[model samples]
Target: MRLYRMRLYRIALWVTVPMALPLLAAPAGLTAVRAARDTAPEGAPSVWRPGVTAQPVDAGRPFPALGAASMALRRMVPRPAIVSRAQWRADETKRDSHAHYAGGVRAVFIHHTDTPNGYDCADVPRTLRNLYTGQTRDRSWGDLGYNFLVDKCGTVYEGRAGGADRAVVGSHTLGFNQGTTGIAAIGTFGPGTPVPAAMEHAIAALAAWKLGLSGVDPTGKVRLTSTNGKSRYARGTSAEFDAISGHRDGFATNCPGEALIARLPAIRGLAAEIQGRYARAVPFPRLAATPGNTHRG
Candidate 1:
Protein backbone atom coordinates (compact mmCIF):
# COMPACT_ATOMS: atom_id res chain seq x y z
CA MET A 1 0.00 0.00 0.00
CA ARG A 2 1.14 3.56 -0.71
CA LEU A 3 1.80 5.64 2.41
CA TYR A 4 2.06 9.36 2.05
CA ARG A 5 5.06 10.91 3.72
CA MET A 6 4.26 13.13 6.69
CA ARG A 7 6.44 15.64 8.47
CA LEU A 8 5.92 14.16 11.93
CA TYR A 9 8.83 13.37 14.22
CA ARG A 10 9.63 11.29 17.30
CA ILE A 11 12.85 10.96 19.27
CA ALA A 12 14.53 7.64 18.48
CA LEU A 13 16.62 5.63 20.92
CA TRP A 14 19.04 2.98 19.70
CA VAL A 15 20.78 0.12 21.50
CA THR A 16 23.45 -1.10 19.12
CA VAL A 17 25.25 -4.07 20.61
CA PRO A 18 25.81 -7.74 19.93
CA MET A 19 22.39 -8.95 21.06
CA ALA A 20 22.34 -12.44 22.63
CA LEU A 21 19.60 -14.96 23.14
CA PRO A 22 18.49 -17.06 26.19
CA LEU A 23 18.08 -14.26 28.78
CA LEU A 24 17.33 -10.58 28.53
CA ALA A 25 16.61 -7.71 30.89
CA ALA A 26 13.11 -6.32 30.32
CA PRO A 27 10.74 -3.72 31.68
CA ALA A 28 8.22 -4.71 34.31
CA GLY A 29 4.42 -5.04 33.77
CA LEU A 30 5.19 -6.67 30.41
CA THR A 31 4.42 -10.21 31.44
CA ALA A 32 1.04 -11.03 30.00
CA VAL A 33 -0.19 -12.95 26.90
CA ARG A 34 -3.69 -12.23 25.66
CA ALA A 35 -4.76 -14.91 23.13
CA ALA A 36 -6.65 -18.17 22.86
CA ARG A 37 -6.08 -21.37 20.84
CA ASP A 38 -8.45 -23.85 19.27
CA THR A 39 -7.86 -27.37 18.02
CA ALA A 40 -6.37 -27.53 14.53
CA PRO A 41 -7.76 -29.74 11.79
CA GLU A 42 -6.62 -33.33 11.71
CA GLY A 43 -3.65 -34.14 9.43
CA ALA A 44 -2.67 -30.48 9.43
CA PRO A 45 0.95 -29.57 9.93
CA SER A 46 1.94 -29.33 13.58
CA VAL A 47 1.94 -25.88 15.19
CA TRP A 48 3.81 -24.94 18.36
CA ARG A 49 0.98 -22.90 19.89
CA PRO A 50 2.10 -22.85 23.49
CA GLY A 51 0.81 -19.29 23.78
CA VAL A 52 3.00 -16.30 24.59
CA THR A 53 4.99 -16.93 27.69
CA ALA A 54 7.08 -13.97 28.78
CA GLN A 55 9.54 -11.86 26.88
CA PRO A 56 10.33 -12.66 23.25
CA VAL A 57 13.60 -14.27 22.30
CA ASP A 58 16.11 -12.01 20.60
CA ALA A 59 16.48 -12.62 16.84
CA GLY A 60 19.94 -11.03 16.56
CA ARG A 61 22.00 -13.71 18.23
CA PRO A 62 25.49 -13.96 16.83
CA PHE A 63 26.30 -16.84 14.53
CA PRO A 64 28.50 -19.59 15.83
CA ALA A 65 32.17 -19.21 15.02
CA LEU A 66 33.03 -21.06 11.84
CA GLY A 67 36.20 -23.12 12.04
CA ALA A 68 39.24 -21.48 10.50
CA ALA A 69 38.84 -23.67 7.40
CA SER A 70 35.07 -23.35 7.30
CA MET A 71 35.13 -19.63 7.97
CA ALA A 72 36.98 -18.97 4.76
CA LEU A 73 34.81 -21.34 2.77
CA ARG A 74 31.30 -20.93 4.13
CA ARG A 75 29.13 -17.88 4.81
CA MET A 76 28.02 -17.27 8.37
CA VAL A 77 24.30 -17.56 8.92
CA PRO A 78 22.67 -15.82 11.88
CA ARG A 79 20.49 -17.94 14.16
CA PRO A 80 17.44 -15.87 14.95
CA ALA A 81 14.83 -17.28 17.27
CA ILE A 82 11.92 -17.50 14.87
CA VAL A 83 9.44 -18.02 17.68
CA SER A 84 7.50 -21.00 16.31
CA ARG A 85 3.82 -20.79 15.43
CA ALA A 86 3.20 -22.95 18.48
CA GLN A 87 4.92 -20.41 20.73
CA TRP A 88 2.13 -17.97 20.03
CA ARG A 89 -1.44 -19.25 20.51
CA ALA A 90 -2.14 -20.05 16.83
CA ASP A 91 -5.78 -21.06 16.45
CA GLU A 92 -5.67 -23.27 13.39
CA THR A 93 -9.41 -23.76 13.08
CA LYS A 94 -9.27 -21.87 9.80
CA ARG A 95 -5.95 -23.29 8.57
CA ASP A 96 -5.90 -24.19 4.88
CA SER A 97 -5.40 -27.64 3.43
CA HIS A 98 -1.67 -27.13 3.00
CA ALA A 99 1.04 -24.51 2.71
CA HIS A 100 2.93 -23.60 -0.48
CA TYR A 101 6.71 -23.86 -0.79
CA ALA A 102 8.76 -21.91 -3.29
CA GLY A 103 11.61 -23.48 -5.26
CA GLY A 104 14.13 -21.17 -3.60
CA VAL A 105 14.70 -17.73 -2.24
CA ARG A 106 15.27 -14.87 -4.68
CA ALA A 107 14.27 -11.76 -2.72
CA VAL A 108 13.06 -10.42 0.61
CA PHE A 109 10.21 -7.95 1.10
CA ILE A 110 9.82 -5.63 4.07
CA HIS A 111 6.50 -4.41 5.45
CA HIS A 112 4.87 -2.63 8.42
CA THR A 113 1.81 -3.74 10.36
CA ASP A 114 0.44 -0.18 10.59
CA THR A 115 -0.61 -1.17 14.08
CA PRO A 116 -0.10 0.98 17.16
CA ASN A 117 3.56 1.55 17.98
CA GLY A 118 3.20 2.25 21.68
CA TYR A 119 3.11 -1.37 22.77
CA ASP A 120 5.61 -2.87 25.19
CA CYS A 121 8.01 -5.47 23.76
CA ALA A 122 6.46 -8.19 25.88
CA ASP A 123 3.03 -7.77 24.30
CA VAL A 124 4.32 -8.74 20.84
CA PRO A 125 3.14 -12.34 21.07
CA ARG A 126 -0.41 -11.33 21.88
CA THR A 127 -0.36 -8.78 19.10
CA LEU A 128 0.82 -11.37 16.59
CA ARG A 129 -1.83 -13.80 17.80
CA ASN A 130 -4.51 -11.18 17.28
CA LEU A 131 -3.11 -10.42 13.84
CA TYR A 132 -3.28 -14.10 12.89
CA THR A 133 -6.87 -14.24 14.13
CA GLY A 134 -7.84 -11.29 11.98
CA GLN A 135 -6.11 -12.60 8.87
CA THR A 136 -7.47 -16.12 9.11
CA ARG A 137 -10.82 -15.52 10.79
CA ASP A 138 -11.78 -12.06 9.63
CA ARG A 139 -10.14 -11.78 6.24
CA SER A 140 -10.72 -15.50 5.63
CA TRP A 141 -7.16 -16.07 4.48
CA GLY A 142 -5.76 -19.53 5.04
CA ASP A 143 -3.06 -18.29 7.40
CA LEU A 144 -0.96 -15.30 8.44
CA GLY A 145 0.25 -13.60 5.27
CA TYR A 146 3.76 -12.60 6.24
CA ASN A 147 6.43 -15.26 6.58
CA PHE A 148 7.93 -13.66 9.67
CA LEU A 149 7.33 -10.66 11.92
CA VAL A 150 9.70 -8.38 13.79
CA ASP A 151 8.52 -6.54 16.89
CA LYS A 152 9.57 -3.03 17.84
CA CYS A 153 12.01 -4.58 20.32
CA GLY A 154 13.72 -6.58 17.55
CA THR A 155 12.28 -9.99 18.26
CA VAL A 156 11.42 -12.19 15.25
CA TYR A 157 8.32 -14.36 15.30
CA GLU A 158 7.41 -17.00 12.76
CA GLY A 159 4.34 -15.89 10.78
CA ARG A 160 3.18 -18.61 8.37
CA ALA A 161 2.97 -22.32 9.29
CA GLY A 162 5.89 -23.38 7.06
CA GLY A 163 9.45 -23.71 8.26
CA ALA A 164 11.10 -20.33 8.72
CA ASP A 165 14.26 -21.50 6.97
CA ARG A 166 12.22 -22.56 3.96
CA ALA A 167 10.93 -20.33 1.17
CA VAL A 168 7.35 -20.81 2.27
CA VAL A 169 4.89 -19.07 -0.03
CA GLY A 170 2.63 -16.59 1.73
CA SER A 171 -0.35 -14.35 0.97
CA HIS A 172 1.75 -11.27 1.62
CA THR A 173 2.39 -8.90 -1.30
CA LEU A 174 -0.38 -10.58 -3.28
CA GLY A 175 1.06 -11.32 -6.76
CA PHE A 176 4.67 -11.26 -5.55
CA ASN A 177 4.65 -13.87 -2.78
CA GLN A 178 6.36 -16.60 -4.78
CA GLY A 179 10.17 -16.76 -4.72
CA THR A 180 10.15 -14.11 -1.98
CA THR A 181 9.81 -13.87 1.77
CA GLY A 182 7.80 -11.18 3.57
CA ILE A 183 8.97 -9.70 6.87
CA ALA A 184 6.57 -7.28 8.55
CA ALA A 185 7.57 -4.87 11.26
CA ILE A 186 4.97 -4.87 14.02
CA GLY A 187 4.32 -1.14 14.23
CA THR A 188 3.36 1.84 12.15
CA PHE A 189 6.31 3.94 11.05
CA GLY A 190 5.72 7.42 9.75
CA PRO A 191 8.18 9.86 8.25
CA GLY A 192 10.79 11.25 10.65
CA THR A 193 9.88 8.61 13.23
CA PRO A 194 13.23 6.91 13.51
CA VAL A 195 13.09 3.16 13.06
CA PRO A 196 14.44 1.40 16.12
CA ALA A 197 18.05 0.25 15.85
CA ALA A 198 17.32 -3.14 17.35
CA MET A 199 14.44 -3.71 14.97
CA GLU A 200 16.61 -2.79 12.01
CA HIS A 201 19.33 -5.13 13.19
CA ALA A 202 16.85 -7.95 13.52
CA ILE A 203 15.57 -7.37 10.03
CA ALA A 204 19.12 -7.30 8.70
CA ALA A 205 20.03 -10.50 10.46
CA LEU A 206 16.94 -12.24 9.12
CA ALA A 207 17.55 -11.05 5.57
CA ALA A 208 21.15 -12.15 5.76
CA TRP A 209 20.25 -15.64 6.86
CA LYS A 210 17.33 -16.10 4.50
CA LEU A 211 18.90 -14.59 1.40
CA GLY A 212 22.32 -16.03 2.05
CA LEU A 213 20.77 -19.47 2.04
CA SER A 214 20.72 -19.12 -1.75
CA GLY A 215 23.84 -16.96 -2.10
CA VAL A 216 21.65 -13.93 -2.84
CA ASP A 217 23.17 -10.58 -1.95
CA PRO A 218 21.17 -8.11 0.10
CA THR A 219 22.95 -5.23 -1.67
CA GLY A 220 22.17 -6.73 -5.05
CA LYS A 221 19.00 -6.77 -7.15
CA VAL A 222 16.67 -9.42 -8.61
CA ARG A 223 13.91 -9.65 -11.20
CA LEU A 224 10.45 -10.69 -10.03
CA THR A 225 7.33 -11.30 -12.11
CA SER A 226 4.07 -9.71 -11.09
CA THR A 227 1.04 -12.00 -11.24
CA ASN A 228 -1.60 -9.42 -10.40
CA GLY A 229 -2.38 -6.31 -12.40
CA LYS A 230 -3.44 -4.53 -9.21
CA SER A 231 0.23 -4.48 -8.22
CA ARG A 232 2.65 -1.82 -9.39
CA TYR A 233 3.48 -4.08 -12.35
CA ALA A 234 0.94 -5.51 -14.75
CA ARG A 235 0.48 -9.26 -14.72
CA GLY A 236 3.40 -11.20 -16.29
CA THR A 237 5.65 -8.14 -16.04
CA SER A 238 9.22 -8.67 -14.83
CA ALA A 239 10.46 -5.95 -12.48
CA GLU A 240 13.85 -5.49 -10.94
CA PHE A 241 14.04 -4.73 -7.20
CA ASP A 242 16.74 -4.44 -4.58
CA ALA A 243 17.39 -7.78 -2.96
CA ILE A 244 15.91 -6.23 0.17
CA SER A 245 12.89 -4.10 -0.71
CA GLY A 246 9.77 -2.66 0.84
CA HIS A 247 6.24 -3.90 0.16
CA ARG A 248 5.50 -0.66 -1.67
CA ASP A 249 8.15 -1.56 -4.22
CA GLY A 250 5.91 -4.26 -5.68
CA PHE A 251 2.40 -3.07 -4.79
CA ALA A 252 0.61 0.28 -4.96
CA THR A 253 0.38 0.86 -1.23
CA ASN A 254 2.18 2.92 1.37
CA CYS A 255 3.39 -0.17 3.08
CA PRO A 256 6.39 -0.38 5.34
CA GLY A 257 6.18 3.42 5.79
CA GLU A 258 8.75 6.03 4.81
CA ALA A 259 10.78 5.92 8.04
CA LEU A 260 11.30 2.19 7.83
CA ILE A 261 11.70 2.30 4.06
CA ALA A 262 14.46 4.87 4.38
CA ARG A 263 16.43 2.54 6.65
CA LEU A 264 16.28 -0.29 4.08
CA PRO A 265 19.63 0.64 2.57
CA ALA A 266 21.39 0.37 5.89
CA ILE A 267 19.50 -2.82 6.60
CA ARG A 268 20.68 -4.23 3.29
CA GLY A 269 24.28 -3.30 4.01
CA LEU A 270 24.14 -4.81 7.47
CA ALA A 271 22.55 -7.97 6.11
CA ALA A 272 25.30 -8.28 3.54
CA GLU A 273 27.91 -8.03 6.26
CA ILE A 274 26.14 -10.67 8.32
CA GLN A 275 26.18 -12.96 5.29
CA GLY A 276 29.87 -12.34 4.61
CA ARG A 277 29.00 -10.86 1.24
CA TYR A 278 32.49 -9.47 0.85
CA ALA A 279 34.01 -12.90 1.12
CA ARG A 280 33.81 -15.78 -1.34
CA ALA A 281 30.41 -17.47 -1.27
CA VAL A 282 29.59 -21.14 -0.77
CA PRO A 283 27.25 -23.55 -2.53
CA PHE A 284 23.52 -23.19 -1.93
CA PRO A 285 21.83 -25.62 0.40
CA ARG A 286 19.79 -28.41 -1.15
CA LEU A 287 16.20 -28.92 -0.03
CA ALA A 288 13.48 -31.32 -1.22
CA ALA A 289 10.57 -29.64 -2.89
CA THR A 290 6.86 -30.29 -2.39
CA PRO A 291 5.49 -30.21 -5.93
CA GLY A 292 2.77 -27.78 -7.06
CA ASN A 293 3.04 -24.03 -7.68
CA THR A 294 -0.33 -23.27 -6.16
CA HIS A 295 0.34 -22.80 -2.46
CA ARG A 296 -3.07 -23.93 -1.09
CA GLY A 297 -2.43 -21.45 1.69
Candidate 2:
Protein backbone atom coordinates (compact mmCIF):
# COMPACT_ATOMS: atom_id res chain seq x y z
CA MET A 1 0.00 0.00 0.00
CA ARG A 2 2.83 2.38 0.88
CA LEU A 3 4.64 1.59 -2.40
CA TYR A 4 1.47 2.07 -4.43
CA ARG A 5 0.80 5.45 -2.79
CA MET A 6 4.40 6.59 -3.50
CA ARG A 7 4.07 5.52 -7.15
CA LEU A 8 0.78 7.45 -7.55
CA TYR A 9 2.30 10.59 -5.99
CA ARG A 10 5.31 10.44 -8.39
CA ILE A 11 3.03 10.14 -11.45
CA ALA A 12 0.95 13.16 -10.33
CA LEU A 13 4.15 15.15 -9.76
CA TRP A 14 5.46 14.38 -13.26
CA VAL A 15 2.20 15.44 -14.93
CA THR A 16 1.83 18.64 -12.88
CA VAL A 17 5.49 19.60 -13.41
CA PRO A 18 5.14 19.43 -17.19
CA MET A 19 1.98 21.55 -17.17
CA ALA A 20 3.36 24.14 -14.73
CA LEU A 21 6.65 24.44 -16.70
CA PRO A 22 4.80 25.69 -19.81
CA LEU A 23 2.77 28.16 -17.75
CA LEU A 24 6.00 29.54 -16.25
CA ALA A 25 7.83 29.77 -19.63
CA ALA A 26 5.02 31.22 -21.77
CA PRO A 27 4.80 34.62 -20.06
CA ALA A 28 8.54 35.20 -20.30
CA GLY A 29 8.60 34.29 -24.02
CA LEU A 30 5.61 36.50 -24.79
CA THR A 31 7.09 39.39 -22.82
CA ALA A 32 10.35 39.20 -24.77
CA VAL A 33 8.47 39.24 -28.10
CA ARG A 34 6.42 42.27 -27.02
CA ALA A 35 9.55 44.12 -25.93
CA ALA A 36 11.31 43.41 -29.22
CA ARG A 37 8.30 44.69 -31.18
CA ASP A 38 8.04 47.86 -29.08
CA THR A 39 11.73 48.64 -29.47
CA ALA A 40 11.73 48.38 -33.29
CA PRO A 41 13.23 51.37 -35.17
CA GLU A 42 11.20 54.02 -36.94
CA GLY A 43 10.26 53.40 -40.61
CA ALA A 44 10.56 49.72 -39.88
CA PRO A 45 7.26 48.04 -40.75
CA SER A 46 5.31 46.47 -37.90
CA VAL A 47 1.84 45.15 -37.18
CA TRP A 48 0.86 48.68 -36.17
CA ARG A 49 2.18 50.25 -39.41
CA PRO A 50 1.08 48.03 -42.27
CA GLY A 51 2.59 50.31 -44.89
CA VAL A 52 0.82 52.62 -47.36
CA THR A 53 -2.37 51.44 -48.95
CA ALA A 54 -1.94 50.42 -52.57
CA GLN A 55 -3.53 52.95 -54.94
CA PRO A 56 -6.27 51.57 -57.13
CA VAL A 57 -5.47 51.39 -60.83
CA ASP A 58 -9.11 51.04 -61.86
CA ALA A 59 -11.98 52.20 -59.68
CA GLY A 60 -13.91 55.30 -60.74
CA ARG A 61 -15.57 56.04 -64.04
CA PRO A 62 -13.19 56.88 -66.90
CA PHE A 63 -13.58 60.11 -68.84
CA PRO A 64 -16.57 59.83 -71.14
CA ALA A 65 -15.37 57.84 -74.13
CA LEU A 66 -13.39 60.18 -76.39
CA GLY A 67 -16.03 62.31 -78.08
CA ALA A 68 -16.02 63.97 -81.50
CA ALA A 69 -14.86 67.26 -79.96
CA SER A 70 -11.99 65.51 -78.16
CA MET A 71 -11.09 63.61 -81.35
CA ALA A 72 -11.15 66.80 -83.42
CA LEU A 73 -9.02 68.56 -80.84
CA ARG A 74 -6.50 65.70 -80.87
CA ARG A 75 -6.29 65.77 -84.65
CA MET A 76 -6.22 69.58 -84.97
CA VAL A 77 -3.45 69.84 -82.42
CA PRO A 78 -0.51 68.82 -84.62
CA ARG A 79 1.84 67.65 -81.89
CA PRO A 80 3.75 64.92 -83.71
CA ALA A 81 2.70 61.70 -81.94
CA ILE A 82 3.22 58.09 -82.99
CA VAL A 83 2.09 54.80 -81.42
CA SER A 84 4.82 52.14 -81.37
CA ARG A 85 4.46 49.03 -83.59
CA ALA A 86 5.21 46.59 -80.79
CA GLN A 87 2.31 48.11 -78.80
CA TRP A 88 0.05 47.40 -81.75
CA ARG A 89 1.33 43.81 -81.90
CA ALA A 90 0.78 43.36 -78.18
CA ASP A 91 -2.74 44.67 -78.53
CA GLU A 92 -3.28 42.07 -81.25
CA THR A 93 -1.84 39.25 -79.14
CA LYS A 94 -4.07 40.25 -76.21
CA ARG A 95 -1.10 40.31 -73.82
CA ASP A 96 -0.40 42.79 -71.01
CA SER A 97 -3.43 44.85 -72.03
CA HIS A 98 -6.17 46.32 -69.83
CA ALA A 99 -9.70 45.08 -70.39
CA HIS A 100 -11.33 47.79 -68.24
CA TYR A 101 -11.24 51.59 -68.50
CA ALA A 102 -9.23 53.70 -66.04
CA GLY A 103 -10.57 55.90 -63.29
CA GLY A 104 -10.58 59.72 -63.45
CA VAL A 105 -7.32 61.26 -64.69
CA ARG A 106 -5.23 62.99 -62.04
CA ALA A 107 -1.58 63.75 -63.00
CA VAL A 108 0.92 63.47 -65.85
CA PHE A 109 4.38 61.89 -65.63
CA ILE A 110 7.07 62.33 -68.30
CA HIS A 111 10.00 60.04 -69.21
CA HIS A 112 12.75 59.54 -71.84
CA THR A 113 13.59 56.17 -73.40
CA ASP A 114 17.34 56.96 -73.12
CA THR A 115 17.72 55.59 -76.66
CA PRO A 116 19.84 57.12 -79.41
CA ASN A 117 18.60 60.42 -80.86
CA GLY A 118 18.95 59.41 -84.52
CA TYR A 119 16.27 56.73 -84.09
CA ASP A 120 13.14 57.76 -85.98
CA CYS A 121 9.83 58.07 -84.11
CA ALA A 122 8.05 57.00 -87.30
CA ASP A 123 9.75 53.61 -87.01
CA VAL A 124 8.92 53.44 -83.29
CA PRO A 125 6.80 50.33 -83.79
CA ARG A 126 9.69 48.42 -85.35
CA THR A 127 12.11 49.76 -82.76
CA LEU A 128 9.84 48.71 -79.90
CA ARG A 129 9.27 45.28 -81.44
CA ASN A 130 12.98 44.68 -81.78
CA LEU A 131 13.56 45.80 -78.21
CA TYR A 132 10.84 43.44 -76.93
CA THR A 133 12.05 40.40 -78.91
CA GLY A 134 15.53 40.76 -77.35
CA GLN A 135 16.90 41.86 -80.72
CA THR A 136 18.23 44.96 -78.97
CA ARG A 137 20.68 43.08 -76.73
CA ASP A 138 21.58 46.13 -74.67
CA ARG A 139 18.05 47.04 -73.59
CA SER A 140 15.61 45.42 -71.11
CA TRP A 141 11.81 44.91 -71.27
CA GLY A 142 9.88 42.74 -73.71
CA ASP A 143 7.83 45.56 -75.31
CA LEU A 144 7.24 49.33 -75.52
CA GLY A 145 7.19 50.63 -71.96
CA TYR A 146 5.33 53.91 -72.34
CA ASN A 147 1.64 54.76 -72.83
CA PHE A 148 2.40 57.58 -75.25
CA LEU A 149 5.52 58.30 -77.35
CA VAL A 150 6.28 61.76 -78.76
CA ASP A 151 8.70 61.84 -81.67
CA LYS A 152 11.18 64.61 -82.49
CA CYS A 153 8.74 65.84 -85.14
CA GLY A 154 6.37 66.87 -82.32
CA THR A 155 3.88 64.15 -83.24
CA VAL A 156 2.16 62.08 -80.52
CA TYR A 157 1.52 58.37 -80.95
CA GLU A 158 -0.88 56.11 -79.05
CA GLY A 159 0.60 53.36 -76.92
CA ARG A 160 -0.85 50.32 -75.08
CA ALA A 161 -4.44 51.57 -75.07
CA GLY A 162 -6.92 48.83 -75.89
CA GLY A 163 -9.71 51.32 -75.35
CA ALA A 164 -9.96 55.03 -74.60
CA ASP A 165 -8.99 56.03 -71.05
CA ARG A 166 -8.23 52.46 -70.04
CA ALA A 167 -6.04 51.79 -66.99
CA VAL A 168 -3.20 50.18 -68.89
CA VAL A 169 -0.40 49.21 -66.53
CA GLY A 170 2.93 50.72 -67.55
CA SER A 171 6.55 50.16 -66.46
CA HIS A 172 7.25 53.85 -65.98
CA THR A 173 7.92 54.33 -62.23
CA LEU A 174 7.63 52.46 -58.98
CA GLY A 175 4.54 53.30 -56.88
CA PHE A 176 3.39 56.08 -59.29
CA ASN A 177 1.36 54.38 -62.02
CA GLN A 178 -1.86 54.63 -60.07
CA GLY A 179 -3.83 57.76 -61.04
CA THR A 180 -0.96 59.01 -63.24
CA THR A 181 -0.62 59.22 -67.00
CA GLY A 182 2.88 58.57 -68.40
CA ILE A 183 4.21 60.24 -71.54
CA ALA A 184 7.62 59.38 -72.95
CA ALA A 185 9.67 61.19 -75.55
CA ILE A 186 11.43 58.96 -78.11
CA GLY A 187 15.02 60.14 -77.60
CA THR A 188 17.23 60.99 -74.67
CA PHE A 189 17.46 64.60 -73.45
CA GLY A 190 20.37 65.93 -71.41
CA PRO A 191 22.53 69.05 -70.93
CA GLY A 192 23.22 69.53 -74.64
CA THR A 193 19.70 68.88 -76.03
CA PRO A 194 16.50 70.32 -74.61
CA VAL A 195 13.02 69.15 -75.45
CA PRO A 196 11.71 71.01 -78.49
CA ALA A 197 9.20 73.82 -77.91
CA ALA A 198 6.64 72.07 -80.10
CA MET A 199 6.92 68.86 -78.09
CA GLU A 200 6.54 70.76 -74.85
CA HIS A 201 3.50 72.59 -76.16
CA ALA A 202 1.88 69.33 -77.22
CA ILE A 203 2.47 67.71 -73.86
CA ALA A 204 1.11 70.77 -72.10
CA ALA A 205 -2.05 70.83 -74.17
CA LEU A 206 -2.71 67.14 -73.71
CA ALA A 207 -2.20 67.41 -69.95
CA ALA A 208 -4.41 70.49 -69.70
CA TRP A 209 -7.27 68.88 -71.59
CA LYS A 210 -7.11 65.75 -69.44
CA LEU A 211 -7.05 67.78 -66.24
CA GLY A 212 -9.98 69.88 -67.44
CA LEU A 213 -12.03 66.77 -68.05
CA SER A 214 -11.11 65.43 -64.62
CA GLY A 215 -12.09 68.73 -62.96
CA VAL A 216 -8.62 69.08 -61.44
CA ASP A 217 -6.68 72.35 -61.53
CA PRO A 218 -3.57 71.70 -63.60
CA THR A 219 -2.03 75.02 -62.61
CA GLY A 220 -2.06 74.13 -58.93
CA LYS A 221 1.45 74.45 -57.44
CA VAL A 222 3.42 71.70 -55.71
CA ARG A 223 6.53 71.80 -53.53
CA LEU A 224 8.65 68.63 -53.33
CA THR A 225 10.91 68.99 -50.28
CA SER A 226 13.74 66.76 -49.11
CA THR A 227 13.26 63.94 -46.57
CA ASN A 228 15.04 66.21 -44.06
CA GLY A 229 12.13 68.72 -44.36
CA LYS A 230 14.08 71.20 -46.53
CA SER A 231 12.28 72.63 -49.55
CA ARG A 232 13.60 71.01 -52.73
CA TYR A 233 11.37 72.92 -55.12
CA ALA A 234 10.03 76.40 -54.43
CA ARG A 235 7.33 76.91 -51.77
CA GLY A 236 3.67 78.10 -52.16
CA THR A 237 3.41 76.35 -55.55
CA SER A 238 0.62 73.88 -56.33
CA ALA A 239 2.26 70.50 -56.91
CA GLU A 240 -1.00 69.45 -58.58
CA PHE A 241 -1.01 72.51 -60.86
CA ASP A 242 2.62 71.77 -61.53
CA ALA A 243 1.22 68.53 -62.99
CA ILE A 244 4.53 68.06 -64.79
CA SER A 245 7.01 65.92 -62.84
CA GLY A 246 10.09 63.82 -63.64
CA HIS A 247 10.48 60.04 -63.28
CA ARG A 248 13.34 60.59 -60.85
CA ASP A 249 10.90 62.11 -58.35
CA GLY A 250 9.72 58.65 -57.32
CA PHE A 251 12.62 56.42 -58.39
CA ALA A 252 16.41 56.50 -58.73
CA THR A 253 17.12 57.26 -62.36
CA ASN A 254 18.21 60.30 -64.42
CA CYS A 255 15.14 60.07 -66.64
CA PRO A 256 13.42 62.95 -68.47
CA GLY A 257 16.89 64.61 -68.35
CA GLU A 258 18.02 67.68 -66.43
CA ALA A 259 17.18 70.13 -69.23
CA LEU A 260 13.59 68.87 -69.37
CA ILE A 261 13.25 68.99 -65.57
CA ALA A 262 14.61 72.57 -65.60
CA ARG A 263 11.69 73.55 -67.85
CA LEU A 264 9.12 72.11 -65.38
CA PRO A 265 8.32 75.53 -63.92
CA ALA A 266 7.36 76.89 -67.33
CA ILE A 267 5.50 73.74 -68.25
CA ARG A 268 3.50 73.90 -65.03
CA GLY A 269 2.70 77.53 -65.73
CA LEU A 270 1.29 76.58 -69.12
CA ALA A 271 -0.87 73.88 -67.53
CA ALA A 272 -2.18 76.39 -65.00
CA GLU A 273 -3.08 78.78 -67.78
CA ILE A 274 -4.98 76.11 -69.62
CA GLN A 275 -6.82 75.16 -66.45
CA GLY A 276 -7.85 78.79 -65.98
CA ARG A 277 -9.28 78.90 -69.46
CA TYR A 278 -11.25 75.69 -68.95
CA ALA A 279 -12.54 76.84 -65.55
CA ARG A 280 -13.96 79.94 -67.18
CA ALA A 281 -15.71 77.79 -69.79
CA VAL A 282 -17.19 75.40 -67.18
CA PRO A 283 -17.91 76.93 -63.80
CA PHE A 284 -17.75 74.59 -60.81
CA PRO A 285 -20.96 73.50 -59.07
CA ARG A 286 -21.97 75.32 -55.87
CA LEU A 287 -24.10 73.97 -53.05
CA ALA A 288 -27.61 75.43 -52.70
CA ALA A 289 -28.80 76.75 -49.33
CA THR A 290 -32.08 75.52 -47.79
CA PRO A 291 -34.80 78.16 -47.08
CA GLY A 292 -36.34 78.36 -43.60
CA ASN A 293 -40.16 78.24 -43.56
CA THR A 294 -42.50 80.32 -41.37
CA HIS A 295 -45.95 79.23 -40.00
CA ARG A 296 -48.37 78.57 -42.90
CA GLY A 297 -51.85 80.22 -42.92
Say which candidate scores most in lDDT. Answer: 1
TM-score per candidate, in order? 0.68, 0.53
Clashing pairs in 1: 1-253, 1-254, 2-253, 2-254, 3-254, 48-86, 48-87, 49-86, 50-86
RMSD of 1: 22.6
After aligning candidate 1 to the native by TM-score, how far in Å is the CA of 50 from where it should be? 24
- Candidate 2: Cα lDDT at 271: 56
Clashes of each: 9, 24
Tens digit of per-residue lDDT, candidate 1, span 18-115? 44666543334243322211112111223333322221111122332544321223255967766777777677666675666654577899999999
C-alpha lDDT values of all predictions:
0.70, 0.48
lDDT of 2 by residue, 110-158 (tens): 8887878786445656545544444112332222445576656555656
Give the least accurate 10-residue stretch of model 2, judged by summed lDDT. Answer: 33-42
Q: Pick the TM-score winner.
A: 1
